[model samples]
Target: MSTTPLEAGIIPLVDAAPLIIAREIGFAEEEGLDLRLHRAPSWSSLRDMLALGQIDAAHMLSAMPVAMALGLGGFAERIDVLSVLSVNGNVIGCSLDLAARMRAAGYGFDFVDATAAGRALIAAAGDTPRIGVPFPFSMHAELLYHWLGALGVQAPQALRVVTVPPPLMAQAMAAGEIDAFCVGAPWGSTAVEDGVGELLLPTTAIRAFAPEKVLAVRHTWAEAEPDLTRRLMRAVWRAGRWLDQEDNCLTASEILARPDYLNVSSEVVERSLTGRLVISPRGDLRSVPNYLVFFRGAAAYPWRSQAALMAHSLAARSGLDRAAAVKAARSIFRTDLYRQNLRDLGAEMPGATDKVEGAMRDPTAVASEAGHLILEPDAFFDGFIFDPTGDE
Candidate 1:
């Protein structure tokens, strides 16, 4: 087997573990692939690097490919989501002063009531607070808008949305640059550790099973090297499965905490891996199952409905044609490619390529090639469901 060298780009976040683990644990080597990982500090830089062919693939935000497909970022080339990397690992954090103000305003930081949190935030800050997100087109931004909008706080008008890199979020908050932030894990934990912020709510409170990050590749590269793509997908899938085991959580965190990787403390990274999050500076802990999902419950499947949901949100926010945006976004998920490449490996993939998003209210058994697959509830907090094929 010839060793094919491939460069993959990633941001320093807990969700980028699968790509790092695959290369570190010999999964890529076993597939006859030599993976070179590149660390990118910001989302736009990583997106541009992937777009300009600076990297073969990347660990990208779930909505990025859809954004590229809709021409939102002015990138000409189309990108494809080969698989999901992580789901529902984001948390909203507010500065210590803002948190104290919210508490004084009769808000309970229970981390379950998103509407109350939003209303309290509005009351305490009075439309003047600046909230930072990792990117404009990320699940962090979408969930923040959805949660606040559901509570009658109009976005970009009632409050400001700012873009800050995830790694720099803690420092930004400490420096009084942003009052609050909705970002992926470890960074939020870092803020809590640094005595700068307190956790307000998890993105799961807005929408459980929110797709967070994906294994993305350029369409041109995927089409030109079909075999290599299959090999890469299989290797990454194996790494994800290895990551799902409870015993491997600490080891995974340690690997991610390396200076060459996330460059954070292993203890902070382990919080997300173990689903035991410290929500406050005073060590208030919460047990959130499936916090940073890698493999269980078809977590890696590239669902078209997920893409369509992102498309609808972006279209509604940006004033684009909903139908056209949904159509273009649906093509980027590449569910057909996922099924074609992973089925032979006996992957427990959903029989249907698309389903009603956020409709399941329980762990229901569904049709699958390899017997039954139990899908967990992905209901929205407002009891809304996204029907990609219907007038949602």
Candidate 2:
């Protein structure tokens, strides 16, 4: 049988592992997909490639499809998030000088206490700090806003936001173009390794199990080639499950460290996979077990509640119609597609598409088609929970 050829655009990041692993370990081939991976220089380029039909799917920021669906970035297209690719892989860090200032100001570099850390950063940077994020429409940007706003730091007034691709984040910081950044591994590890920045906290510190990236497919293509889309999701889903295994961390790290992948050392990539992050040039290590999740606790499921929360965040900034955007965002997540594709695969399909985001305080068993789905803790550090009804 002839294999269906599909191409995906991705930036070099550790969370892109599932897509790479799908191709590397024959998961794609097993599902009759001839998957070709293309490397984009930046998120904007990757977004354009996906929007322009240059690729069949993309390893995209979790918020990208919703942002596009809501017509935020000037270029609007119907996109579907087939499933979440990775969760909670991002870290916030500052230049070594800023790190020193923050440390000198009596703030210990403990990975917990995100509020205290933000307050310390505010105190350390008296002037507005120029912070870089991968894209304006990214979880990095949203979380930065969420974290800073929680501490009463008015954005663009207390801190300036700029765009720096993941690969160039460390260089930008080193060159003083950006004072700090919120980016995913191994780029955070790269910044620390290069002696330029110190990792302060994982984004999970702000919102544990925060949706990060998605296995995104253009909606038109998915509708036209349903079988191909389902096959691709199943293939990548299997790869994500394989990646979450503790035993596969080392090998997964080595594979992602190849030049065509993250192009960093296996040791750097391994830090994220193992959740043992080297936070500073001084080799300060912090263990963040929920730092990066692939398949655990229904991480891959495209929860509509998450989409609603992101839509709310974006709505606040853009002054978009909150209700309409939330509805559109929820629709774009394509939870139905995820369920349709993976239900028969013995996956523990969630009983409900929407939930109270950031409400779970511990491992709680939820209703599932498979009868057993224990969800991980997903509380915001500030103890705020999102009402899916837009009640706040």
Candidate 3:
């Protein structure tokens, strides 16, 4: 049996587990794919690699495809999101100096409660808070804007936004280049390990069930190679399902900790997998359920509403027309492709392609083909629900 060789780009982060697992755990091979993983230095480089046909697919920021579709980010290539790879794995942390200031100002670092955390972050950050995100068009930036803007900070205007790659975030903090950062684990956990920063809040505290990363490919490539696309999606989907199982955490962490992959300690990687984080140098432990969701509760489903929300944010910030942006962005999340690939594999899929973003407050059962799809809580901290159809 001849396997099709496919190259994919990824950044070194815990959320890259699905791609790593698909290769390491034999899922990709099972699907007749010779999956080759390339670790890029940053999100921008990875995005460009995919754009330039350097890689067939990528573990990409969810907002990247949408931002590209909206004509932001200076990339004109169309990138389609095949499926969501991981959901809600980001952490907002502050430098040791900022943490001390926040602590002295009576901020408890509760590691939840976005509203209180936002207020305290604002007060402690003074007039203009210097914050770091992996990319300007990433969910980290969008959530930061949404979370802080809701809490009376003007955001992006009243804040100094810095673009630091995930691997370099801890170094940026240690050097006092960034006052705070919102990044994916185990990079955030790495900062704590390095004694440079303390975790303040998981992005889940801002918006539960945010689409963090997607399995993305060039739109032209997906269309040209439908069979390969289908095979790749199924392979990664299987890996995500396996990752969500509690028993696989140890093995998955070990695989991800290899030097070829994330290259961090398995213990550090496992913390993100299990949602148990050591937030501070003093070792304050916080357990957050569903912190880095891989597959449960339709986490891998490519919801167009999620894309619309990201598009809405990008448009509002970039001066693009909201309606046009949403329309373009929603099409990029390829739910049709997801169904075409994974439906026969007993993958439970939501019957609807889009939903009111941030509306679910609990594990609510929705209409699905399998009749057992219960969506996890997806409410925004401020209780804002975005109706993709009702953009007025």
Candidate 4:
């Protein structure tokens, strides 16, 4: 009886729940991956470890692989992102004053209207608003840029974008070090709960399928250990499915709140998980359900629309050509690996065929009534897997 150790890095956010749960619930062990879960304090810390193969893999941001693939920032290598850990788990939170300014400015504070508020924040802050995001290359920063630019408000050189850990987001908001923050769950909801800030937008408000965290591996490692990568992806997919069960939200929240994981209260975690979001009980915000989702059937699969968006985002940010950026995006966002793992696992699957599109159709439309099982549409997008190296 030999234990095969697979070292993996994780960050302290709910989006990392899939990796943590896969380890804690025996899925990784069953797969013969003796998982050694190490906590990386920040995204850069996690990225460096994965880039250098210090850890075999990491729970990462959806944009990270794209940015790294395009050499957007200081990340030197072309790393590959094998799978998305979770999608649409982020939110935009602002100080009470910032929230008020938004209302006074006549912009609805949901994702669809975030462009207005994001630009308004930049305009109101003028020289600098001292905004906080987890990491520069993470989805938070990319999304901030998209939302701001959508309103014709470029992130001027004067606007400050700082890195703050998810746990510290609440304290920073209370201390007034940051004017607004775009962060993963618990922290954003925690701020409003404590009267330190107000919830501005549920991330789903803008794009329902925004990619949050991903399973990132060194490009070389993925090429060398295809079996290990498949095993890892299967474990993640299983863990994701396990978390999606309606009855499992409470249990999953407990797992995530342990000191070794997210280290947040179960109450704070639940709000994000079940959409019991308390959007300012006494204020103008409204509470909503279906907030945080580990698995929403086909919603969990790594769709290519998200990959293209990441490509476009990295290109826009780094001033790269759009075609080259899309090519970079396809390399890492591989659905073939995902499909192989699904077949090996004998898991019930969505019937997503080779078609690639910006959005996936409702799985319920094609699912057989016997199992109530949802299937991703066959040819869901137009020839989705044509080239893992795109811009075609």
- lDDT of all predictions: 0.88, 0.89, 0.91, 0.71
Q: Candidate 3, 202: how far from true, in Å?
A: 1.1
- Per-residue C-alpha lDDT of model 4 across residues 77-132, encoded as one tens digit per residue: 76776677787677788888776776787666653344455666766655567778
lDDT of the structure predicted as candidate 3: 0.91
Q: What lDDT, from 0 to 1, does candidate 1 have?
A: 0.88
Q: Runs in model 3 with CA error above 4 Å?
A: none
**Residue by residue across 192-292, what tens digits does model 1's lDDT show?**
88889999888887788889999999999999999999989988998999999989988998999999998888988898888788988899999886678
Least accurate stretch of 10 residues (summed lDDT) in model 1? 150-159
Q: Which residue ranges in model 4 land beyond 4 Å of their true spot?
A: 103-130, 155-160, 174-177, 281-290, 346-392
| RMSD (Å) of each candidate, 1 decimal | 1.3, 1.3, 1.0, 4.7
Judged by TM-score, which candidate is best?
A: 3
Local lDDT at 284 for model 3: 92
Cα miss at 82, model 2 (Å)? 0.5
* Per-residue lDDT of model 3, residues 59-88, tens digit only: 999988998998877679999999999999
* lDDT accuracy of residue 374 in candidate 4: 59
Worst 10 residues of 3 by lDDT: 151-160
* lDDT, candidate 2, at 203: 91
